[model samples]
Target: MAAVSPSPPAAASIDRGDSGLQAYARARLAEGDNALGLAVAGYRAALKQDPDRVEIARRSYVQALESGDGALALQSAALLDGAGMLPRDGTLLRIGDALARKDWQAASALTDRMTQEGNFSFLSAIVRSWIAVGQGNYAPPTIDAKDRFASLGQRYLDEHVAYQALNHRDLSAAIPAVRRALVARARDGAALRLTFAAQLAGIGARDEALMLLPADHANFNVARAAILRGRAKEQPFTPAQGYARLLARLAVDISSDPAGRALGLRLARMATFADPLGAEPHIVAARLLVEQDHAGAAVQEAAKVPAKNWFAPLAQAELIDALAASGNLAGALALARQQASVPGAEPERQVRLGRLLAESRDFDGAAAAFRAAQASYEPDKLPWTLLLFEGSALEQGKRWTEAREVLERAARIAPDEPAILNYLGYAQIERRQNVEAALELIKKASALKPDDAAIADSLGWAQFVTGNVAAAVPSLERAALGAPTDATINEHLGDALWTAGRRYEARYAWSAAAINAQGDVAARLAAKSEEGLKPEYAAP
Candidate 1:
């Protein structure tokens, strides 16, 4: 969820504590990134000083929800709702709670209130259907209700109809709705296909079930695994599984919109409430939590996935990311290593292992892990980004020739990729080979991303090496301005400035560069600042 706007506080709340503390907390929450943890702490401190401040209480609720502290959110939400100021998310939770208790009357009443509020009105049909099913009265939606969803809304409409039809043992009705939902959207068909496959399996239609499976879709892997298990067991989707599927699909759909995280969280939580035994719902909620920088909560959600479920490996992979994000890098690496050794672990886990290794500067180990990941892809269809990563690792390891070979192949496959062009061009310039060719490649890369500081630095260095010091100075200056603290860019700018007779500024730039420079570069920059450029750095 985006950070909440602070409500106007009463005079008593202001006088109760340092107003500055409350203001600081609000500012930090609004600032985004990893500030949620600190914001929560700040809000807690402020709230302790003024427990009756509804504004502060509401802000705490938002921070808690955004941080994926659902239990805390529920508590804070209770306070707000008790004060007759429950937010939209709180309303969703309230409705979900009603549904959980099989209080159809309360659920229907809450849903009506939600509709009146013009929030989550899209959920009215689904919730009503659930209520109907619970009451042993399955009401098929009217034609007008079905017609209201002819376009993109049709997907949700289809889900509602199919779910009700399934509960009523009306497969003929369910099948057409499933097909329309699947056929209408090229993307997001996994959940619909999964539901359809499960229903088919329910009726012993094994061939139809297998036929509905999509090829190589990442989001559908768990569903595929579940379908396979059903095939083996000769069974169908349980009612809880069906409910979980509906909630999962809704969560996925909402998550696609940039402003839908809050709604997505509510639906995911609802899914968990509706089907406590289903691992997929928890995994979905965990992923959304991770996206909002709630790694601790994400880890908690992932931990809820039963170890025996087919989704356990998926949970473990997500836990690896959560651990890393929560600043438990060693734990993440240990888990990654364990995951990698499993006989049939997913290739994505190995890819993750390589990234963690690369971050730790184990370049050789990272390259090996990357190779193992690459082996998972078909040879002819390897992704360009993968090559770029492997090439970068090789370059950082000082395996220059291998790096060049890999980068060149990447450039061929994705000729317009500015990163590949810049890296390959910069590598050529660094080795002092084919200066003119390097200049052309860097120029192409710079044209593609004119404001990129690293590419600008490469462009400047290439010009300086080819005896164009005057021409190089402007580009180098731009690069330094764009990335003021990057040692290499500042050092490059310093060299160009000295060559252009700006000697005093050259020393100033070198001093700044020296702060972050290391090893040979630091020594070289020191010598240049005190005396002048070595013979190597002088104008050609």
Candidate 2:
């Protein structure tokens, strides 16, 4: 994401009288590299120079908000609004600008107009609530029962306003509100709990607050410990902070659904500027940026979360993901290791480290991390899952004896878990150990999870290894359908297809496997595609 060094615009385009073409070309290049901030800048400059270009102004408005360029968003949004072609999110930018300047009348007027629109009335309600706070007689918005978005609205947005309305003024109603929000699985679950607990402690009800957090849950464990130490206590949100929270959560929710993704991202970028110091907005923005494949922007957003914020640890996880996504695997691993080494780190932190290590193909290190997590956790907490993780890592590292022993322990603890059953059965079949028992285990697993691709693959491979070619083909085909891009499964399917006399189809399957295959697997897949299945390539 280097600065926009615009290559010379094509002479023909310049002669065509488009002066902004050079800037537009630079913006396109930045967009290709996922440098959203740089792209936004180029688009902004292009829009300024070519104010009549509605397309440029619209793109600038969206990119400006996506890049957290509040001023640029306002400029483009105003341009678009003046042209009478602004979208709902562009209007939101204008409204946010009004809110920032404390122009309550303008903000309220914009929000009221939004209420007349067919959708996003919930968002308008949030904006109106913020404006009301400024006017000194604030009344939170109520959810409209008959509205088409009532389910989604009541789920998260209205709960925040309701919680604020009841809990801010009447402390007695806080517990019920918190319970309802938690039960509804509010979008900002951890942050909501922290805020609720903080409000409890603020009124000398520390005991009640402590009781709300059970010792066993990972995030809650950290909160409980921190609360006891008189640390990580967030103060009550101001009107601005509350407004930001509602917008951020709503933005994330909207971005998750495909129909309104761009609008959501634009709104989220606005949320970041609304309360710059608030952790929730940055966390939401970072996560959304990561999902959108803008790793650089995600990293920048995650870094904005203050260390003292309760959401800092969660933000750090986002930072690690952003680093990994941006191809800085070593840096991501090093940071994960550093975080995992924090004194009295929770089991979840260790689990996260193990996951990162496993992704990096450092199986031995991943196994160690999973083992450490297992040791640190309470006796009944995800014990079998941790054992399965360590066992899989050991298997990948070729420490099969240890892997077998650990996997057996997991099987004993979770006798009916399909994953454990499939893993142990598949490992045994691959090793030519206890074929009859392994087949039974695989059969049971398939019965338990009939639609699981990996389980189907394992069962098919089990049949192939035992020389049941006719029985394996259907299961192998089913596995391939469920996991179209899985190289190993495709290779297995090719072997079965070749054995079943589908020569051309077998070659096609092998070619598919070769698409993303690497090293020894690539060589094997290529050989199978060219020479058909050899004795070495197929199961015995």
Candidate 3:
């Protein structure tokens, strides 16, 4: 009792410790590597000594919850509560997590406690609404809570609740809620009103819905307005001009959003009957249809584009692809010829036409087209990738000798190219010659892109042919994992598994390949598997 410590120094020491703890906490949070884990560990250690540190405990609890440590989050939450500085957000997050896990009783109790606290009334009300929904209480949330939410800059919440009301088939309740939301933020909120208006029209409240939509909302673009005008016409065919304008505006709109693109396509389809000479609509319709995977419909729509338009050649190419995909080889070939004959066609068009011709089994015509294209431009001037197409076309035509010669030239020109190496190696493998050299080439390609499924399959196939069936399984498995949907890889994996004495797994894989394989490869694999025979499957 004789020696008393200086009060100022003791206070300074406590302040210094608090500052160090704060620094440690912030540093742990700022770190990128497992920040949540490090932060929780750092804060918990500091808080053990500085037990009254409310902010630190709150942050620690948040980090713990975010890192999915529920017990630790609860411990920190209790600590913050004891310290009398609990964050509203932390409580809400914890309650939400409990609700997500279907701990409704715990969530309800927590919400009741939060409501009694009176500090986070808005948040508590939102949670109560969600809890009521979870409990199958279909009644709309209290009006007082809705009004409080609207006052808190959360009008979207009102609209969202209205949408839920609509989902519950209570459009009458939804109408007033949505109208309130629109009134809160009209300029930036026109879209929501428009959507609600559409719903109201569906519910036989067309006059009321029309009254809600502003006559000249700034966000309403010409195309959308035209569509709305056309829809509002008394006579069914009276708004033909408006429909044409809508189709024209739609061509520009499709570039930005998929929904807009779809709407554009519909308007263009309608415009075709209204104005057949307007090629713009049909061209836009075809492109949008292609995007939607309606390739056959795309081909039909593209056929309506005027021949004088610059899009004619591009449209013909699309038709070629669509017809090819539909197994209409004759139609595809005809479209390819049309694309080739188009005046002043670009080099890409020529390449596309030649590829389509080769795809349709008109390899001779493809060869002539490729030869002409090659002659028209120097090798150094054209894209190096063009050589791959020309060489592969030669291979498909059974001009193996010419194919090999061209592929060899391409290999020399682009020695580090993975696709060239894989193609040439697979070509050599398919020819049943140069097995050792093909293995080496494919191994090199795999080293360059270890995760490339096609190259892995080729390496596995090469190993299988060289009688190293044991080494083939790992490579084939990797290939199958990387390209689970590829019929060729699945077929190869099946063969490798069959050779490895895994007959049951092999049969399952072979069945998958048979179901999904395309063209001649599909027919061959399906027939071979059905015959209970393990034939050599080559890579394409």
Best by lDDT: 2
lDDT of 1: 0.73
lDDT, candidate 2, 1-540, per-residue tens: 224455432323323233575677777777776677667767866876787888888887777888888888788878888899888766566676677777888878887877776466756655666677767766766667787777766766545664465435555555666687777755566666766676676655678778766565555655677778876445555555666776777787788787867667766787777778777788888888878888888888999987666677778878988988888888888888887887666676788789889998999999999998887767666589999999999998999999999999999999999999999999999899998799889999999999999999999999988889898989999999999999999899899889989999999988888897899899888877877788887633
Candidate 1, residues 311-340, lDDT tens digits: the string is: 566778788888888889899999999888
Off by over 4 Å in 1: 1-51, 67-71, 78-87, 109-277, 288-294, 341-346, 450-457, 467-540
TM of each candidate vs. truth = 0.72, 0.83, 0.47
Give one digit per residue, the lDDT tens place, for model 3 in 489-536: 888888788778887888788888877777888876776566544444
Model 3 TM-score is 0.47
Model 3 ranges off by over 4 Å: 1-285, 322-328, 342-344, 517-540
lDDT of each: 0.73, 0.77, 0.62
What clash pairs does model 2 have?
Answer: none
**TM-score order of candidates, top first:** 2, 1, 3
- By descending lDDT, how would the candidates be arranged? 2, 1, 3
- Clash tally, candidates in order: 0, 0, 0
User: What local lDDT does model 2 show for residue 354?
Assistant: 95
TM-score of 1: 0.72
Candidate 2: count the clashes. Answer: 0
* Candidate 2 residue runs with Cα over 4 Å from true position: 1-18, 123-127, 144-148, 157-169, 197-236, 252-264, 375-378, 381-384, 408-418, 436-452
